[model samples]
Target chain A: MKRVNILLGGPKSEYPDELSKSIKGIPGPWVGADRGSLYLLEQGIIPDIAIGDFDSINKKEQRLLKDNIADFKKFPPEKDDTDSELCLLAAREKYNAQEYYVYGATGGRIDHFLVNLFLPFDPRFLDFYDKLYYKSATNTIRFCKPGRYKIYHENGMKYIAFVNLGPVTHLNIYDAKYKLKDFNAGHPVSWASNEFLNETIDFGFESGIVAIIQSKD
Target chain B: MKRVNILLGGPKSEYPDELSKSIKGIPGPWVGADRGSLYLLEQGIIPDIAIGDFDSINKKEQRLLKDNIADFKKFPPEKDDTDSELCLLAAREKYNAQEYYVYGATGGRIDHFLVNLFLPFDPRFLDFYDKLYYKSATNTIRFCKPGRYKIYHENGMKYIAFVNLGPVTHLNIYDAKYKLKDFNAGHPVSWASNEFLNETIDFGFESGIVAIIQSKD
Candidate 1:
């Protein structure tokens, strides 16, 4: 699978350690969005493509990034798409990336976080559901279409949550600490803070969009 | 209006300073949910009612909270309603509060944050759309029904965002840096990172639910 990791300019936690562990064996092209390029440089991972308005980084950092990266696309600060959106476009259109993982797309600023949250729901990105992810130090978020799904157990994360992006119907969960059967979330309600009891969790829903988050404190 | 503030056992930031400013003149009864009671005690504000399963708090904290507050309702760890949901019920059904402000309901866990985000979208809580809020140290989140609304400028918060909880049609924004006129968000997209340019913002939609957040970094 052609997995692409796109770094965004949002917030950071105990990132470097977590980043190393999260992408231990998954080797893919790294794309940076604005200040994310500087972060990649700090982590000693040179990006293949640096795309954004480049407003968040200082002049010195910008010069350093330009000197290091060859395929860099700069835009005006005032634009229709956000810096992250532009990076996603480059990842999808330019590289035709099959699988995408996004980092630094959440935390600190709720506006940016909300923008990332709604990205999966955008009509233009609908087909990328289940293929794209919003990853952070503490959480890994993925969008799901209505169908049966199985999740294998993973360490380092404790809680599993399902957030309905739209009205969800006939939802079911099994082999989890908090099990649900034929539950319908009328709106965008959350079945949050659930635990993994068995080696895997089996879940399915009839209709609507869902976001599953495997999170740790 | 009879406004009541409910604090949940979710997450917190440099809360005291921001909480003090957010509710400086908004004097009303305070309610606590589970560990939220301990947080209130730390702030030297004893709650009128403490409602929750009480599993998140230590035994010592529970004892101290019981001695500090006169009214407390404890439930089993496994229950139908979330601790925060029970607190909202007390605020709405028991106290008959006209307006509610929620704190300590977002920040740490995505599950809890998702629960808080979907509270206003619940069928039982739909009638209280404009009256309920999920407030935190950095952001103030409120839900709006389909109607024209005007928002006056507020200090501290520099950005305003609109996230569609459902498909929003005929959406409009005026007096802002990025104005939207007669546009429809086909899905639950975020109109994020907008600035207030005219000391106010006027927005409305023909249908669907909307969450407005006044936020800062």
Candidate 2:
């Protein structure tokens, strides 16, 4: 399986201390979106492909990137698709990768962060929801469909929450510190701040999509 | 009209440059949640009421707050309602405030931010959705029920976006740079990055809750 990771151009203020250790050596090629290319270079990991408008970075950095990076595709700044979306498209078309891990999509402007949450709604990216993920040092967000899923306990994030992406029915949560019986959520309710009591967490829903956000304070 | 502004203890990393000027003398009593009280004190503003667990602040600071502030409510750390919720309740019950402007709700843990987004879902808060707002330096988030509304343009935030809090039908947008006719959104899709062309934006939806976020980069 070909796996790809995407780096966005979000603010550097909220980068958790553990990000470097968590992504030090993963199993795939990296793609940079906008200022993420500069971030990737700073982290001593050169991306295989760089995509974005390059508006956030200055001309000096852009020159340096063009001179060093072998494959760089720049788009007009006013284009319809965000740089993050273009990066995913490049990853799929060029690398043929269906699985992706995303970084730098949070901790900046709320509008930008919120838009990233809805990227899976696009018709082109609909089928890849289960495989798409947004990760940071303290949090991991995954989109899920109606199905049974088991999540292993991890030391990094202490709390697991289910946020409704749409109206959900017969939602069941089990084996956690705070367990819930079959419940229905009509809106994008936050089933928040649940701790993992055992080694694994088992959860399922009869219908509707959800985004599971596992995080630590 | 009794208007109260609530400040939370969320991260200060993304505070916009124009926040100070924008909120200089807004007519309202200020309330703080947790460390937000200390933040307000630092800014030379004494909160009318401070509400939180007080775990995030040191003992000396807590003592100082007790010595200065007349009304302070401390809750057990393990409570059902978050500090933000307690502060809002106080604003309503004690101050009889139906309108509120919130700060320090964004740019923190995803779980915390996500919970702030769902505050209006509670039955007690249903009627206060339009009057309740979460305003950060870069973004202003407001919840609204199904109805026709007009949003005036503000200097601090140039872009307006609509996100579905629930399934919305017959949504329409007008007098904006990027206009939309009657449309339906089944999921929490982000209709983001729309610019305001005229002095106001007119929009309406037939059913369900929606959140409007106006922001600037």
Interface RMSD of each: 1.9, 1.5
lDDT (C-alpha) at residue B199 in model 1: 78
Query: Among these predicted structures, which one has the highest DockQ?
Result: 2
- For candidate 2, the TM-score of chain A alone versus the native chain A is 0.90
**Candidate 1 per-residue lDDT over residues B1-217, each given as its tens digit:** 4888888876566243557554445478889999888877887788999998887778998899888888889899778788878888877876777889888777667777777777776777776757887776667788899999998766788888888876678888967889888776545777888889887899998998888988886
TM-score between candidate 2 and the true structure: 0.91
True contacts kept of each: 0.65, 0.63
Lowest-sum lDDT 10-residue window in model 2 chain A: A14-23
Candidate 1 Cα errors over 4 Å, as ranges: A14-17, A20-26, A183-186, B14-16, B20-26
Model 2 per-residue lDDT at A15: 61
True contacts kept of 1: 0.65
Give me candidate 2's interface root-mean-square deviation: 1.5
Q: Write the per-residue lDDT of candidate 2 for residues B129-206, one digit (tens) a residue.
A: 578878877788988888999988877787888877667798888778777788787777777788887888999999
| Candidate 1 clash pair list | none
Model 1 reaches an interface RMSD of 1.9
Error in Å for residue A141 of model 1: 1.1
Give TM-score, chain B, model 1: 0.90
